[model samples]
Target: MIIKTVKSLSQALLLVALTLVLHSCSNPDEGSAIETVVYPSDVIPFMDQWKILLGDGTHTDEVEDYEAPNFFYVANDGEADWVVYKTPNAGVTSRTSSNTRTELGQIEHWTPETGGKLTGTLKVKHVSTSGDARAAASYSVVVGQIHSNEGNENEPLKIFYKKFPGHSKGSVFWNYEINTEGENAKRWDYSTAVWGHDMSVVGSSPKTYPEEPEDGIELGEEFSYEINVYNGIMYLTFMSAEHDTVKFTKNLLQSEFTSKAAIPKQILTLYVSLGRDGIERKNAYAGEIQYFKQGAYNQTNGKDPEDNMVWSTGSAIYDGDIAKQYANGSYTEVWFKEATVGPGTAPN
Candidate 1:
């Protein structure tokens, strides 16, 4: 009897040992299998400095550790992760404009005399392919800008990228919207070419395309821009590996078009339909408070090209359906690797 009892005790001990071993093996360290993904704020730390509006009309001021899945997110391009800003050709837009956009508006405001500086390194991934070629704004996207916070909410500066479908290259240009001296209805924009024809150049017909610029930048190509408004002087610098670097200087405190005679032919043709023939103020954007903006401000829309060819883009919209618009290639996507914003520096 004693021998039988001792044997039973030994078997019970063996069973307990096996159970402990199995439990430890089944539950390994919790940290071993988890991998963290980097976000847009990780690449560009300035996201917290401004507020963002998504293509779906999502507005948020907290962007430091925030990201929207389809509109604003981080994407890996085989080489590195980039912050992407994408928007449909037609979607919910801001109250002041009819165009759609996924862009950032700076929180801080400044005047022409006080000045500010903004820099960005980015690439245009895609743009709307279908639009009236004769329209001044068709098939174009605004990447960066300076907008007035008061008065007519007019823009002081807008940088544009335009490319026709099936074309190998696109034009890069910047526009200066006049701060009307009196009536705000007289406001107009003047454009300057960086690597192609200015905004004034357009096709004779809706289907026709002008000769491609020889020194234009192509889609997916990398480029950088610096907009420095220092001591009432606006200085611009554009750089790309495929073309020569370009630099321009304009006075923000003074008007280049004080009379109708100073208006360019492009503005005459582009604004003729819109009735924006107003002359600029003697002091262009001098005392007015302005803010900066960046991202994909889609210039295309679903409006009929026949009504207003220049501003109206006839792009396809699946009745405000985001997934359908993306599938149909009716959206704009831009990626930015680096950017900075701060007080303007003193001129050398």
Candidate 2:
């Protein structure tokens, strides 16, 4: 009888010890210190601090609105197909370069010209035909401009922006068809994309985009193009463009689309043209983008329009306390204009 009583007491002690351990592990302050996992929602507040959302917290100011947003559903074979959303339709408007019919769907075009800024609402919805499908999660996205032209007049198609941060420069490259993994990707997540002229004519080689972050998708179910910039030189695979593997790289940047972001001091440049394909190009540093407001007098070449419309704009970089404006409209070509990479370095 005494041994039985002792065993019960010992079990009670072990139970108490287990409870204490669990309590310690669960404590957010002391003990094991519960680690708070940061999901997309958790980091949104920080994104707001950077002021990347369009329309602040409201839904009225849409960067570009579609009566129905584009939808791609996972087919029975586990492949995601580009399906149209009946409720919120999707199609390329007349403003866009591409002409996608209703059956093919459309995309609303919004660029710096639309507002010179991208802060707005994009409502996305999904409905499942099967009961076991993933629950439809709606989203509202804000796309902001990151970089404009390459600061060279010869190449006008180059445009960059923070589509959703935590991606790579190529994420914003020209004509790359971004196949997001899930629905409501723009607002629910972040990515970055950048593109430039591929000076090397050697050409036609298999290419890879910059490595994507764990929280993002790089080339998920999409035919991406090859127009990546490393160091100072840019590469473009014509084969990719010819086959429409991705959108034409030059057109991608020229469209002047703003993507949502989560960084301060985002630099956006819009390139006009990269000069001719085989002509002698000028140096890139010659390009100088000055302070020219939209609908204001542009003083780049002392050329003033009757309406005082600003052609393009560039950001000034600090060189040893000298804030020199890296003119996006300064050059005609042959040189490379280095963008001031902010604290956020390209993901290694």
lDDT of each: 0.88, 0.21
Clashing pairs in 1: 135-310, 186-278
Q: Which candidate has the highest lDDT of all?
A: 1
Candidate 2 overall lDDT versus native: 0.21
TM-scores for all candidates: the values are: 0.91, 0.23
- lDDT string, candidate 1, 256-341, tens digits: 88888998888887886788888887887888999999999999988887777567877778788988889988889999999999
The TM-score of predicted model 1 comes to 0.91
lDDT of 2 by residue, 1-348 (tens): 999999999999999999988987887568555765322213112122121111011122221221122121111114322222121111221222111111111012222222111111111111111110011010101111222222321222222111121222212222112112233112111122323211111112112222332322122212222233323223333222212332222222221223323111211111112111121112221222211100000111211212111211111112211112112211111001111111211212
- Each model's RMSD to truth, in Å? 4.4, 21.3
